[model samples]
Target: MNETKAATASTPGTHAHTGMTTRHDTWWLAPLLVATGFTLFIVYATFRAFENNYYEIGSIISPFYSPKIDLPGWPFSPAILILWMPAGFRATCYYYRKAYYRAYFLTPPACGVSVWGSKSYTGERAFPFVLQNLHRYFFYLAVLVLTILWYDVFKSMLEPSFHFDLVTLIMTVNCVLLSGYTFGCHAYRHLAGGGLNCFSTNESTKQRFKVWEFVTKLNEHHMAWAWFSLFSVGFTDFYIRQVCAGVFPNPVFF
Candidate 1:
């Protein structure tokens, strides 16, 4: 019975290795890994912001505004960051993937008559590219965030009690960074274009349209601000995090 069992096990296609599955062969691995990296960077920035007590609005030494908010505390290891990276928002990568696939991959190889594997005579514009819609929403959010951050800067400058220090300097820089990010966003560019055809119909609207035209010229380099603002945001958040962590000194330039 033992010999027969051994022979059966040794037979071709009869036995399979039961090892752990690896992520190596997965098609989604690249995008998944990129998403994970983004999450970690944001989380680290959040942790540093909390450490510096960035959430505290009124005073330097006070606790953060949100009692429920929790970011991993430091002398934090990278392993902890990596493990926590997959916690949420698996859908974000789809946005990034689709945007890039069109901008970089799909558009390049497309041919005039060839229609990119689609049916002949079908119009792509009829479907109206959905990913482009995100630029508008992101633009509005950028403007909102920039306004808030700038308000914080103004508020800080207005405070007589704070005195001139590192916190104030950082806040000022943060405001500038946020503006760069907001102005650089793709949607902001569109708005700057004076392309709101319906908005231009009125005599009064024409005056505002001229201003938008002027600003749109600056906004035309959408990609420039996109990258600059992206990095600046990370830097601003990093500075705030450092202030929270007590690892860095908070400056207040009054």
Candidate 2:
């Protein structure tokens, strides 16, 4: 009886050692953490997007509301417009797709775990998954948005008196994190020179090769930058909102 039960448990297609029955210790922890963190960010961002009143303070604009476009007759939040590009870029991001797919969809949630959905895995070959191929295009838009945010950061540092402030420092840090993530993107690394057939043939290609190497180093820690930038952007927005709402006072230091 014991031998029969053991054999049945080890049989393929039984899922007796996979899915909820995974034998690997702490295998479920990673996906659970990812799901919790991602969900919290989504909820906070959604609330902030609709509650747009506290997005600006004096000369500083919240990261969430940069490049503000006010349409006199528009019915919805302007944030929706500015956010859509970054959101799309992130949605199509290679690392993010893996994280969310595991966390949210439970598609093979973790290593050694049985895959969810149908028995046959048709990965990215179908309708919505095909859209991930647009990541490169989204990377272009992300660069445009990053440029705008950097401009905002510079503006935040400029006061009539030339003194550094808390918001200025915060914006600077946010810009650095965001730039790290954006520049470290896989598409950006490819564009830098990953596609080159011959790096030694020309000086220009050599320079591009050097740049690609740097970006490649950055890519090694892309997942860390992704989470850091995600948190930084939201925190920056929240700080700006607090200042705008008179909930917190902005401090200055020379």
Candidate 3:
């Protein structure tokens, strides 16, 4: 009877005024900015992804529409063939999940801030969120796509014959930033050596520990990498698309 009564009793939340936090400053700024930036990118990327034109120029192809797959009867954009890999990888990214969760969902937008109508949480064991476990598999696919991106960049050399252009530099920088963000992932860090309690086990373990150390350094700035790469990739596609659209010529130099 006591247990039932206790369970049925309603209790108020933490003490303090101003909605679970006494903070009077502009605490909502970060999430608001994040939401705005991500929303803009979503709109831009969606338009670019679906429009299916100007995504390629000479040897440069937008990251969104890579590999250039063509099926005999498929009547949709070729991006649907490969874009899902990178999309899935980013969607399941640990840093991105936290980012969108706070910015978009506003499930307690910030530390000590509370959202109305929220219930007790049992972690990501719930539906939809549990799908995040696929991050590791997506990490493997990300690596594969990264390799292909490198191949595309190399093609820039052969097509234009050992010359460099603004697009090449942009593509290279974007690839580097994407690589940093990807290698810094928590899932990738775990693969470097998560379960191992001891790094002194043997030479192999020592090697993995070194890799883990590198990934840890990258993970420390994972958020920064995420943002930079996001901008870089988006700009890369935009610049290439503009060049393809005859808005401007891609300045080339040998």
Candidate 4:
């Protein structure tokens, strides 16, 4: 009886470890690193922009920084920060709770620390694990914001005399980066989750759900998209800085 119990327990443990290894061993880590690096770079760039006396977004009355473009208000900076927050958090979704509880919270694992440091058992306030909940809300916001940014791009294009400068090119690249990031959101996968019966028990929802499921399969791999999107954002900002400093021309893509 004792021997049988030991064998059964060990079998499941082995399988669990194997599954984790398989998931983490894929090309996932590379993209994750890339995304993390990009996210850091963008944060640094934004800080630099403020430090370089370009923080104001078209408030002519303020004696702080002069306005470059006629921006509405303090909209630009806040929007950028808000939009990137989800991207930043989502990047760590793979094993975030474990990292937090281990690194800061100093919680112990039920089974043992897997890999470097992870508790086998989750804590009482499992609510944070509900980080999963942010996916859908962020998805809608990301999509909406991307559409608005694209509109800004169109507005930029309208001015024929506006120099096809590097700053403008960077803005265009930023749009693309945002789109990729938004499309790759986890909630997007849920939104794409097939087999819905909320509206009607017919094929309409089913068919759409099927399409969403395919997209979700791609979105299911959130870590990859997260990193890819991060890199693109950093590159976009870099391009913007180069243009702003007169280092490059913003050539329009044909």
Models 1 onward score TM values of 0.49, 0.91, 0.90, 0.56
On the 0 to 100 scale, the lDDT of residue 144 in model 1 is 49
Backbone steric clashes in candidate 3, count: 0
Worst 10 residues of 2 by lDDT: 9-18
Best by TM-score: 2
Query: Taking the tens digit of each residue's C-alpha lDDT, what string does model 1 give over 110-164?
Result: 1111112222322223444444444555455445445655666656556656465
The lDDT per prediction is 0.44, 0.84, 0.82, 0.47
Considering only N, C-alpha and C atoms within 3 Å, which residue pairs clash in candidate 3? Answer: none
Q: State the local distance difference test value for candidate 3.
A: 0.82
Better of 3 and 4 by TM-score: 3
**Evaluated with lDDT, which candidate comes out highest?**
2
Question: Which model, 1 or 2, shows the larger TM-score?
Answer: 2
- Candidate 3, residue 209: Cα displacement in angstroms equals 1.5
Q: Is candidate 1 or candidate 4 better by lDDT?
A: 4
Candidate 2, residue 170: how far the Cα is off, in Å: 0.8
Clashes of each: 20, 0, 0, 3
Off by over 4 Å in 2: 1-22
Which candidate order results from sorting by TM-score in descending order? Answer: 2, 3, 4, 1
lDDT of 3 by residue, 107-201 (tens): 55666565433455445898888989999999999999888888888898678688788888888999999999999999999999889989999
